[model samples]
Target chain A: MSSQAPETTQIHNIGYRSYDGPRLGRAYARRALFSQSLRGAYGLGRSAKSKVLPMLLFAVMCAPALIIVAISVYTKADKLFMEYTQYAVYLQLVIAVFLASQAPQSVSRDLRFRTVPLYFSRPIERVDYVLAKYGAMASALFVLTATPLVIMWIGSMLAKMDFAEQAKLFGQGLVSVAVLSVLFAGVGLVMAALTPRRGFGVAAVIAVLTISYGAVTTLQGISYTTENTGSIIWLGLFSPLTLVIGLQNAFLGAPASFPGEMQVGAGTGAVYLLVVLGLVAACYGILMRRYRKVGL
Target chain B: MIATESLSKRFPRVTALDRLSLDIGPGVTGLVGANGAGKSTMIKILLGLSPATEGSAQVLGLDVRTHGPEIRERVGYMPEHDCLPPDVSATEFVVHMARMSGLPATAARERTADTLRHVGLYEERYRPIGGYSTGMKQRVKLAQALVHDPKLVLLDEPTNGLDPVGRDEMLGLIRRVWTDFGISVLVTSHLLGELERTCDHVVVIDGGRLLRSSSTSDFTRTTTTLAVEVTDSDAHPDGAASLRAALAAAGVTIHAGVEDGLPGAGHVLLLEAPGEETYDLVRDTVAGLGLGLVRMEQRRHHIAEVFKATDQEEVPAR
Candidate 1:
């Protein structure tokens, strides 16, 4: 490297200078909002205090996969102890907790602070705002649900399991996780958007997830004891968690893990699939309308 | 820079803006109206954030109806309410806003720094907005609007909560936005005097209708009134009364100044000077009354007088 003084010297004035550079259009603006919102979901660009909860929940989500891996290695098992598709079922609480804590952080802060008008006044449209927020929350949930499946797949590989069989199961587990992430994100974002207060948003999301699951499971249990097999299929459709599990069992040919080994038959699974799509679409409809009238 | 025709916005219960039409050109134009006089409503329609019920509008030659995103790309807006987030630093917020306006990441950062500095926020730009004073918060709001370097900026009650000195500084910055950067500004305020000094043109609307729209100089043109003040001494204990009597007896048309104490002067009297000889006539008349003359100056009309006069004209209609 030759060290020579530069011949050209220019002093930039410190006054207001016009910007004549290239400006990306609406698509780029929408993408920027998506990236900002995704980072915000994980509290990446926020203060240290805001980072603690989401990070801790993420760490807690990964712990069970690590322990399962250690148990398989120690036991010298021919096959892994847990099924990849069934992992989310055992850790539903962690997933629900993560959704409860992070969903409000994504949607509620803008409303509570009245910053929605700032976004609307720019090049981004109202529908763009809703889509960006929903996409970010879903991507955050996707990461939350997919990391453990990858870890378990890696563990099975280390445990000297059959590669072809493990790959097929892992692929199926990923599909199920993708579907679950979408459903959960829709539910959580709609709940958060309903209230401007962060605390209320968190509570509403948690209450919807846990209370619906509890009520559906209780109703299923009662109906099963009374030998009412017909209502068991309908009762499981009310909760989001049960609906996803049914979709997985019916469509992916996975074993039924519901209470009492209840089989999710072909017909019930079809209805579950329809309901899931319907619920997600309805959530979008509500979010679009909700953001339209707020902070104007 | 902005034009509207027969614009009307109606809610279920009340009409916010009714058959309002305006034509504004470049430079700093002030939209003067009281609260709920549809200033904010008009801004929303012009920005295309809310649809107008009846009429069409254009900003920077783009139709607000079909080209909302296009118009917003070239325009910046500072809302009236407190809209800054509390937890983020001003720099972070402004940078994000710049990105929202379609600037790339690097340009957004660079523009945010420059705009924050221009708004007089230095080291404090990195601090969280929750700890800032009202003046600092207002600056942050303004910096976000200017970061993208738009061709037009709409400011809504920028001096709503600022103290006297802060109000002056903010107004000076608004004036420079037009002078130094050549960005057209449409600032709204209820106070007429502040706009008299800051705006090149002023538009006054009342009850969702235009009251007056003219240049600031036209509103404050020189009048035929003379303001006279006399010294109150022991010899002439009531010098203002004696001077008023003398001017009236001499057939000079005199009007009363409030309490003989207008804002910056003492014991002043207002008389209509129809011709050139009214000055010499008043001098001789004050000397004959044995009162010392304090000040005798021609008075230029203030915008407040225009506002009051229109207000009186509307009283009978109401």
Candidate 2:
């Protein structure tokens, strides 16, 4: 067609609605994030295969409590081999493996896929993001460690123990488990946030745990042979696992589970708690700073 | 709506956004730039996800430096690269994001459903995102951004990995995000043609600087040249040559289009139409010469031509 003029313009009305709903502020955003990340740590709302690893690790961590209970019931024994607070020390390797395996599932996946931008672009601050992550991981570890502690208490009750003493022990065990889980959660999340790859994060977390445990044990062993109690207490303060046991021994009135005569006193246990808290604070700082520039 | 004054972003090695000053109103605006032209950097700074090295900006009347949380609450952002986690279902992910945006439990699910349906991913939305196609993943990203119904959305390279048909649908959807939802959209793309069809206004940037910012109509103005195509016939198989001669005899000027060695100028003619009278004259001349007029329309400047013309003119944005 030949035309000197162009086509006419017509406007179409699609009736696009404007949203006038109520939008809650930053507090709601942080609460929702904390809940979501808590689910993410346990692989909740994710695929079946994703759920498998966390669930299996959880079951493995609970095995010793179930076994000790069964043995106590069968033998009709009192005062079982595993103390509630000492459980963490007895299964430190398993707990370390669980933390190494599960921590990356919570934080590193966001970094690996560069989804940190999505999280940071919301109403929440960088500090809020790490806090939510810390809360979620700590909650997951509490569930893992406390379930076994409860099971051991049930076994003690079934074995005709003094109900009063068992209840007291359970209370102390809960506190110890809570504190130790905080330590593990803080360290695990920090290591996971430092690297994007899941395998590298897992290896780094396990290496931190294992290497420190080995170094502290060797030093404490040498100190014990030389009858150097001061040196043993000093070296015990360095490893998180040792400090965890030290805190349990000093506060819960539980006997020392460490090798030889390296019994941690109440003063040393108080120092351990302070130092563990410092480590947790340091981890939180690293996480907040890491995310501040990650989105850019 | 977004406004920036002397905004700049600098890294150690390169400057991303340099003295960018933009005033965008509520509508669908397209930000066009090449790779590494600071498109992503501009979006980040506007969202307050990153700080500007110098100057300041505002989104929805909120300061970028002080009100990042408030601005982010009202503005949705879809990043350029793939950032979806692989293990979660699309519904789960979008609902989670909606909740993060402050929608309650039931409201979050309802909005997630509506947004997923609008993006055209129904049955597949239940599957893990790891198994989704690139188009599906892109749609999921869009769904998450829209599930909470923000006042404005910033979509960066929404059609990066789609086929032609998928690109067309995504472009149409982006246009409707404004038309149907009454939301302002700041969508970016490297391809100018993609924006030409959807955007009401376009801002072109090159090398971290503003090259042009104008309404779509002004950017593509109708020029004086008109294209005339003719069909060969038994009376005059060489219709173009005959038409040119007859028009020249009739006091009409024709420019040399594509050369054809034989003065016939192939099947098309580029006529310089000084006025409406020229079009009628050319039409009457073709009919008088016993030739069929295939098409005759005024040519308009394409968006790509702006870049080529700018290269020659070397004019910066005013």
- Point to the candidate with the largest DockQ: 1
Worst-scoring 10-residue span by lDDT in model 1 chain A: A1-10
Model 1 residue pairs with clashes: none
Query: How high is each candidate's TM-score?
Result: 0.94, 0.91
Query: Quality of candidate 2's docking, in CAPRI categories?
Result: medium
Cα lDDT computed for each candidate against the true fold? 0.89, 0.86
In model 2, residue pairs whose N, Cα or C atoms come closer than 3 Å (at least 3 residues apart or on different chains), thus clashing, are A16-B180
Candidate 2 residue lDDT tens string, B1-318? 999998899899999988999999998999998899889999989898788999899999999999999998889999989889987789988988887877887888888888888888999898889999998999999988888889899999999999999999999999989988778999999999998899999998877888889988877889899888787789887988888898889887788865357444477888889899999999898888888998898889888888678756665543
The RMSD (Cα, Å) of candidate 2 is 6.5
Q: What would the per-residue lDDT of candidate 1 be over residues B183-244, giving only the tens digit for each residue?
A: 99999999998999999999999878899999999999888988888877676788887888
lDDT for predicted candidate 2 compared with the true structure:
0.86
- Ten contiguous residues minimizing lDDT sum, candidate 2 chain A: A12-21
**Candidate 1 lDDT over residue span A65-92, tens digit each:** 9999889978978777888778888888
